[model samples]
Target: MASLLDEILFETAGQGPPPSKDFYQFFITKNEVIWRWWKISGRTEFRGTPPEEIKMFHHNFLDDSRFQEQLAVVFGNKILEYTLGLCRRHFDYLERLPDQLLLKILSYMSIQDVGRLSQTSSRFKKICNSEEIWKLTVLGHCDMITEDMEMLAKAMGWKNIFFKFYYKNEHVNMASPAEEEDKANTASP
Candidate 1:
């Protein structure tokens, strides 16, 4: 799996924070870190200046406080910390997993567990809320899912179907024909 991450590990680009107009981009790959910048200013002197770029190996990047400060000034501590983690080769393997596989994995988890997992990361949140996963969940909870139900699921959404079908059926089943049977048995005794 490590070998699969030989390409770009992390990358982001955006304009600097408030009070600044410059744009910045950075890329972290297995071999090097590349930082690029474009000067954006209303002043005439800065208008024609070409974009600048810096390329450094991961080892050099760790010791380059100047670039680290520039990164913080452009983005914030969150991006800076993530960049540093990438430099340290701390890759997020789960994040790299294909969404299809994640959907399969999430389908096996309970609804409560899936809800908690969604809160952990944006990727998990997306997968947890996806229609495909919800379809799987509905199918698993139902003893027999018919073609008409699947068509209805597509029209109304699987999550809504699960709630309406599962919970409504549960509530309907709960209300009282069983009480009559129990009463009859007790009256016989």
Candidate 2:
């Protein structure tokens, strides 16, 4: 079996507004984390002598308190908390899956389930709303798909075609704009 474990890391940098122009670069990896910081000195005499510093710590030796303290010192409490939250979601396997595979898997799901799954992520939302997925779904649910219907779906989109046929009601207006226009033109003087 393939190994499920994986390492994830990212880097972020920020610079404060002018007059207090502070710059920072943070890199986090599986085994180590590093932070570099510098501040622009507006002194004319010390033109090139800006204050700069760097701090690094191994992941193994980093306790929650120490990690939070260091992050707070460099990036403040808000960024520290946001980074921690992002770290928690780094190992999400589903989010890492290829789009083709995700679409194929979603094709097998019920329309309601697919709708719910789309709400989970932007990637999923795109796949779930795609014409290919909807075409697959329409094919799966329908026993007989006429060539004319297939042609119509290509023009109107599978999602629109599916909803039109599936939720059809006599009182509901189902005519395409082109058809409606044709009718109006034919009836007018």
Candidate 3:
């Protein structure tokens, strides 16, 4: 089972182009066990809409519970509430949390949520660009920092912070054995 899943991931990762929204949608359902475990462990909540209706773009809808929680924080209750209301019928068991709680919820969302919520409104744009928020949300994660992420982080005034984290990783790899041997031999014997 693990090998089968690995083969699927390898195939997906090797796609000739960046995945389309539809591809991401299929990506979510491909790991049903993980989704189920997440639900049971309180990491996620499932909605009962027709599976056929689940398109990749629908990922932009109120799909990820963690993402919804973060959007509520970064965009404020008014917009968040309205957004929630939009998808409420489809996702009936969703939780309604207060804004105070919502702020902390930002930490729980995936970086994808940060990017998506940024497109929602100017208010969200502001919060998403907040240095403290980005720091808490994305730093220390494996090279998730990309050029676009840097642009977003810069808007939040954390470009240097992002670069520092990024280059540090590069430095570690560049300092590996072969480079170290050259550096050692080049120095005074």
lDDT of each residue in 1-189, candidate 1, tens digit only: 886574888889999887878898989989899999899999999989999999999989999999899888887889889989988988888788888888888888877799998998988888888889888888787777799998998799998998887756766756467897888889995
lDDT of 2 at 119: 98
- Estimate the TM-score for candidate 1: 0.81
Write one digit per residue (lDDT tens) for candidate 3, span 118-172.
7876666666677766565556555466787777666655635655665467567
TM-score of each: 0.81, 0.55, 0.27
* CA lDDT scores, all candidates in order: 0.87, 0.70, 0.46
Give the better candidate number (2 or 3) by lDDT. Answer: 2
Q: Per-residue lDDT of 64-84 in model 2, one digit per residue for the tens? A: 577567677766787676566
Which segments of model 1 are wrong by more than 4 Å?
Answer: 167-189
Could you tell me how far off, in angstroms, the CA of residue 130 lies in candidate 3 after the best superposition?
1.1
**Model 3 spans with C-alpha error above 4 angstroms:** 1-100, 138-156, 163-189
Model 2 residue 116 CA deviation (Å) reads 1.6
Q: After superposition, how far is residue 57 of candidate 3 from its true place, in Å?
A: 36
Model 3 lDDT-worst window of ten? 32-41
